[model samples]
Target: MKERKIPEPKPLFIERMNRLIPDTNDQKNYWKIVKTEPVNTIRVNTMKINSEELIKKLEDYKWKLIQPWKNYPEILIVEGKTPSEREREILINKNLAKLEPGELGRTLEHLLGYYYIQELSSMLPIMALNPKENEIFLDLCASPGSKTTQAGNVMKNTGTIIANEVSLGRMRILASNLERCGITNTIITRKDGRSFCRKIKEQKIYFDKILVDAPCSGEGTLRSSPKTFLMWNPKTIKALSRLQKELLKSAFMTLKIGGEIVYSTCTHAPEENEGVINFILNEFKDKIEILDFELPLKTRPGLTQWEGKEYDSRVKKTKRVYPQDNNTEGFFLAKFRRLG
Candidate 1:
């Protein structure tokens, strides 16, 4: 009998990660965690449900939920185990299957938008942004509206949120999520994110805060979407990085002098993360300031050097959340403020 072989990312991907993370043991752990499944975490929609009431309703189903933060009861880490074969033998004979871990999304609570099944790391961009009531916000490159809905929750549907996406199909999904989550303050827009920002800048309009959750090579999504291993390409990363830089430039232009912008991505590619931030910092010079912030999860600071390229020193304030460090998808987050 032949032994089963495990799958891994492309050599180029491995090589790049090795370069980014030089520690031999750390690299091994990184790859090991990347191949594992992420934990189930959901964000409670305060607009529609109280965290305690929702927890009471969910616990009746025998699901174990842990609220990682006392202050953030909205974030729930779900954990539950199915009965063993012997324990479930009677139910099996009775033709009934017990609910399992993946069934959270189909629950009544989910359909009612009482909560959103989002990755813990994916929710951090909004947490860091700390959206306030009655403030103008923009989610550039928003699709499927996860962060948009989260922002809507934080703002209690008071402020206006411009959720922009270029693709019509994705825009539809974004609209659906926003509607399902009872997010009334968001306006869906169909346009290239950079061009839309530039146009809005021409109108002399500015946002209080913006989120550029840029699309990238998606190497960080390996656990959820293994196909990213094959889809990873150096050329694609370069192209995406260029587009990200332009989007940041346009977003920066449309930001008020005291406005903040959170740039994030679900990719470990330095060129798309720190490299993009570096490009914007240099182009804008003193006009942009990288902000230092904190999160509930463990995070590493942004890389200052990769592939012989050096980024601005201020980029050290950027946060990098790896799959190994946290039981979630890999994510890069950088918060910025417009100074000039």
Candidate 2:
């Protein structure tokens, strides 16, 4: 028997990223992180168990739990590699928790819905939205339900959240995660997020807040999904940006006057981040405005000029999180408020 070797990601991916990232040191750091392993982190589902209680349970099981340095108190950084199959079985046999096969997901705690295995960066946009209890919310690109269930926890499962996804296959996963997380406030919808406005206007429905976790090239997630290195191209960024713009327009149209929308993506492409936001700012100058919010981790401001084209100055308020900054996946986030 032979041990399979992990293949090295293509250099072309890093070279292209270097050209796109403005800072020399940042570009170097980005490549460095992508080659390394992604962090093992998970969010404690407060809906099912509070952090203190969950921490006690995991600690009793001999698992080391540390809080992530970021402001999200509900999240805990797990130390130590995933246990072996025999060890996992022993833990389960002891009736401590249902032990799964992986580090975060296949755990007794996870099976009971005590925690959600999610990336650190994936939780940021929901933090920015700050969805409130009793308010109406929309997750425009929700699937696999990480953000959707996170929103439910934030709202204490008190508000109505429309979780929409265009793909039926993904919608099934989204529905399953929501059910597993014990999220009852969400109403799942199968519709193209780009046409959300037309679909919901018949009821004169509007949301108090929205989240557009737009689909992108997955550049930031190379550490976990190495195939992104082989598959990413400028054309992917361009096509996703066009779709993102339409989705943003739909989200804005369905949002109440005072409602806020948090736009985010896991890729480092400016075309999908600042470029799309800038284009919308120009087209809906009077209808929307960018809102600044803070994250505890270090982040870069959105680019003003990319490839000789200038973006709206307000786009500077937008944030870009890099793996080097926090040992997490790179992400772009911008908050916008409907003015009209």
lDDT of each: 0.87, 0.85
Model 1 over residues 194-291: C-alpha lDDT tens digits?
88987898888899999999988898888777888888889999999999999989888999899999999999999999999999988999998889
Residue by residue across 1-340, what tens digits does model 2's lDDT show?
1112335656765666777775998777766667777766889999998898998888765665789764677998776534556666765334223233375676688899999989989989998889999999999999989999999999999979999999999999999899989999999999888776677966799999999999999888877787876787777788998999998887888899989999999988889999999988998889898999988788889989787889988889999998888988889999999999
Any runs in candidate 1 off by more than 4 Å, and if so which? 1-6, 82-102
After TM-score superposition, what is the CA distance of residue 321 in candidate 2 from its true location, in Å?
0.7
Q: Residue 44's C-alpha lDDT in candidate 2? A: 92
Error of 2 at 169 (Å): 1.0
Off by over 4 Å in 2: 1-12, 69-71, 81-101
- Cα lDDT over the full model 1: 0.87
